[model samples]
Target: WRRGTNSIAVLGAPQVILYKFGHPSDAWWGVLPYWAGLLILSAPVGLTVYYFLNDHTPPKSTPLAAFLLSLAFISSCVWTDLIASELVSGLEFLGVSLGVSRSIIGLTILAWGNSIGDFVADTALARAGNPRMGAAGGFGGPLF
Candidate 1:
């Protein structure tokens, strides 16, 4: 029932805030050590969405880009938290239904979820013909 390590914060920078997921403090048979790496996809702020709507990058003569960017960012924050919460609840429910303890779910299912991002990013970048940016993304990541 507490906030723990998030995807954007941890996959990007862990030393700053080493968070760990856990069930209720008194629950001895529930989950613990869950590493749910939640990530907000780039479609909200990606160039494709912007280009699809605006037909081009943000213009320098106006504040439209800044305005839209901020709007998207704020919306992202709201949804990310919601999605993360739902994910944990869903996983925990699944664990309970399957007769598996929460701790094991955290250690196994949640941990492997981190690699999903890596797989998607590699495929996306390669298809986009700018795979090098993926490397840069690895170093920079979605930390903003």
Candidate 2:
């Protein structure tokens, strides 16, 4: 993992390290997998971007632009992490009350968010050229 990416993992390192060392509980195991999965996935993305982008392109805008983009991406990830972590932390109650588990919530929320975004964006693009389509976009959509 890249040096910067280490900070992202550091966010959840305590619980994960503790759980791996033999702390056992359903919640502990539950949280561990999510943190581990996030750590594993995030490390590679940062490493890949760092290795490939490090020397390839000239600086754009200014050092500030680079800093801002990095901050933006990290902040976005942190917001997502916050939601996932909060939901996981409260999984037991949520699972019982909602009649579903953390894994199901994660799957459905992420899947539907992406699907909805794609549906909206695609329909928007498709309507971009036609006035009739654009006019219809506000009231009806792709199926219409």
Highest-TM-score candidate: 1
Off by over 4 Å in 1: 1-64, 119-144
Model 2 lDDT, residue 143, Cα: 46
lDDT of 2 at 37: 58
Model 1 C-alpha lDDT per residue in residues 1-144, reported as the tens digit of each score:
011212122232221122222222332335432232221233233333333334333344446446444544655665576678789899999999999999999989986785578767966986799778876776655452
Q: Cα RMSD (Å) per model?
A: 16.2, 11.5
lDDT values for all models: 0.52, 0.54
Expressed as tens digits, the lDDT of each residue in 1-144 for candidate 2 is: 244543444444444443444333434345655445555655654554445443445336766346546655665666677677676667546666978866786687655754685467657766676656554653565345
Task: State the lDDT at 73 in candidate 2.
Answer: 67
